[model samples]
Target: MNRRFVSKVLCLASVSTLVIGTMTGCGSSESKATSIAQIKDELVASTGAMAAESVFSRGVYVNYAKDAENPDKTYFYVFNGDGTGSIEDGAADTSNYFEYKIGKKDVTFYIGSIDPIEEKFTVKSSEDGYVYGSFEDGLELVFEPVSDVEVDSFNATNYVNEQNGHDFVYHDANGWSVKYDPEVITVNAGGPMTTFVYTAESAGTNMITATYTVDKNAEESIKELGKALGDKAFYTEGIFPGTEDVKGYWVVLNPEEGTSGGYVTAMARDYMEGALIFEMDGHFGEDEENNMLVSDTLAGIVDSLTFETK
Candidate 1:
């Protein structure tokens, strides 16, 4: 696997405690504590009914801190009732899937195509409505249950600042638009997908491909694209500004030492009778710093995205 792609997928698994973004937490020494073992036992006895009723099996659970190196990043998880979920880093613009089957003493998380990580989790107390948990590896996470309304508030407050702070803006006739820094970015229009290129003077190139769909739902279409990219494909989802149903996913393949064949971010939204799908591909170079530069630049372009269904 390419290091760049790994970096994106593992952004949610970061080891940090800096309070950032819209979440906050406090230490709890007086709250009740339990282990995954106890929870698993209860779950098994209930024949999966408990899963449907458990708060951990629904909505978004966000970490209280952002990545120390990338403070703008927001890490979170969405655990579905079917033993499947996603690890997400919002500001970093990355997400991936994880499958888990509760064991006697731990929960095994299979994220993307990576080797499974077995977490011996000890659930601590909830402070200010934020749940606290510690893993065997000394990694502690403080999670707050976020509602859809809250998510919309967060997106509106955070991403609104990523507007056209660039030298140029591109508006497609297809009811979508993006802002890009003309210093290092160029646009190529006139195709099914509009291409934006960012070339590092000393390293490699990064690209974003934008398009839409009119026949299916956004989430299902993005998942299908991820599966078509192969089992190694990573998945991502999020709400974009001006839209509630816009979802995104991506995949990386043909990895080399410091670069890869392609790292794609596939996103879509259902509008009226059709859907709008947007995609971004980053082809980074051997220079780790330059790779990060490209990633940040492309992330900004994504942040500046705006669209209309009609």
Candidate 2:
């Protein structure tokens, strides 16, 4: 797994004071606090994350503050076991030059022209494989051991600024973007499914969606896809280019009378930890042929898609 994937989702700072991981005290009678190397050694040893059989798939999600609605004002950091990551400290416009390395509970920082400095962080809590702690300044930190299988995984890096300071544009960790205009679009995030709806605008009431899956096995995954469609769709084994590792199909339904495009779904992209699904559920305007309007639109999006995983 020599992949360099700094997740697009960033773990943002929030003010929910109800800390979540399991807790421990950093102070010991002999020294009150431990050294950086001692902390990392104890942490990795405690979690057994250094082992090969451990299921600590999801990386760490830490925040200095609480979660905020306005992201530009929020700051956070994302860490992975691959020895790679990033930090967003509310610095806008100016590029913040910094590099970091995380070893067990030990973290080293190399900022600007300054020499690399090492710091020891404590694991105040640990739960479900996640560790929660903070800096010497009591900057609340939580190391959420996540599974890529989980859809709404928290981390500020996961949410991309699709809106280039203009329209409320969006594209998810998954690879699809909506064709509908952002102004008229409404997003519903906290659902069993993440859905984007377009009301009577360009493309005539279009809807885009993304679904996450954790089925590492092929047979079980296909079975789940079948359950989702529930027997009304017509699917053709279609090739989603650049997705050679991800075998998939294009599914569509009979368009309604007077509607230009039909419901289109690009089912199953074998991704990083599991899989993803994309569906365009609306009339995609009139193209040369009938169904091509929807299928072609999906195809175009897929072609322009690129994943940032190493």
Candidate 3:
């Protein structure tokens, strides 16, 4: 059987924003402990001419609503200044405009619409080291440090279309040839990396598997790389071509043990360009022909990998 080898690479991009606003009364002093009006005046004086602009700066953006037609909910937005913002909900969209002001230092803006005249547009600034926001029904919005910010890139390495001459087809040791095509290829982009998944089927067996690749140089440590693969098995054999020294891992997944199933093997390798990973999965029963077919297919594909180390 012809061993089909597939490689997938997931890239992630980092997005960061620096905020440079001073808290109203960060210094401990009896005179600094004043009313809200005094705090606002101090902030205005410090801003000078820019006080009139009232512009807010952030690295991300978010929006919230119960429904599109009648948005009764409110949401917070963080703008990254790159024309890209993160929405809290996967279903909500962002507005084209953002607002802020110098007088509202250490303050968060809340956006909501209550009525024609009493729209929920207000800013709650900090005073005496305390920040506060007004909310309906005694609801309060608190500010906290952003946690675990991550961005991902597109996965374009594992291209296995038959018309492109990259289809997986191989011959087995028993002289039985088997070939199959993947059902779908999906790319998930997040945090520091990306993931590509390919689903394929066998002709006679109900088994299916996927082949993938990754960049080893992108990760800071092997343990981190292993964590990124997330709940998958590892292996030392069946590595990509020119990546003999790289480590490998995999996970044996079987919903019904002792019936008919397969396992997933993943390998992490270092390429001159970056870290490269490959995954091969198989599912079969006690049929010797099917088992040998899958084994040979995996071996052939691993042997044919070529790394462009730079």
* Ranking, lDDT, top scorer first: 1, 2, 3
What TM-score goes with each of the models? 0.40, 0.37, 0.27
Cα lDDT tens digits for candidate 2, 137-236: 7676555433342322333322323323333333454544333334445667643256766543355556666666665433345455555766766666
On lDDT, the stronger of 1 and 3 is 1
Error of 1 at 197 (Å): 1.4
lDDT of 3 by residue, 1-310 (tens): 1111011001101100111123334644443334334544544444422322233344322222222454422243444544233324222222223232233323223333322122232334322222234334334443222323322211111111232445433322222122333433333434433333343334332322222224334233344545555555332333334345654443333323664565554455444355444445456566668566655655555555444332
Q: What TM-score does model 1 achieve against the real structure? A: 0.40
Ranking according to TM-score, highest score first: 1, 2, 3
For residues 1-310, could you state the per-residue lDDT of candidate 1 as single tens digits?
3343345335422321121221233333222122323434443444323222233644567665422343332567666757888776655444577886654333556777577565544454333345555567656666667665342223321232333242455667777777777778888887556888886563444677776566576777777877777877776556654555654433334344654545666677665566566676666566778777888888888788776563
**TM-score of candidate 2 to 2 decimals:** 0.37
Preferred candidate (lDDT higher): 1 or 2: 1
- Judge candidate 1 against the unseen true structure and give its global Cα lDDT, from 0 to 1: 0.57
Off by over 4 Å in 3: 1-240, 243-260
Where does candidate 1 stray beyond 4 Å?
1-166, 202-205, 241-261, 308-310
Name the lDDT of candidate 3: 0.36
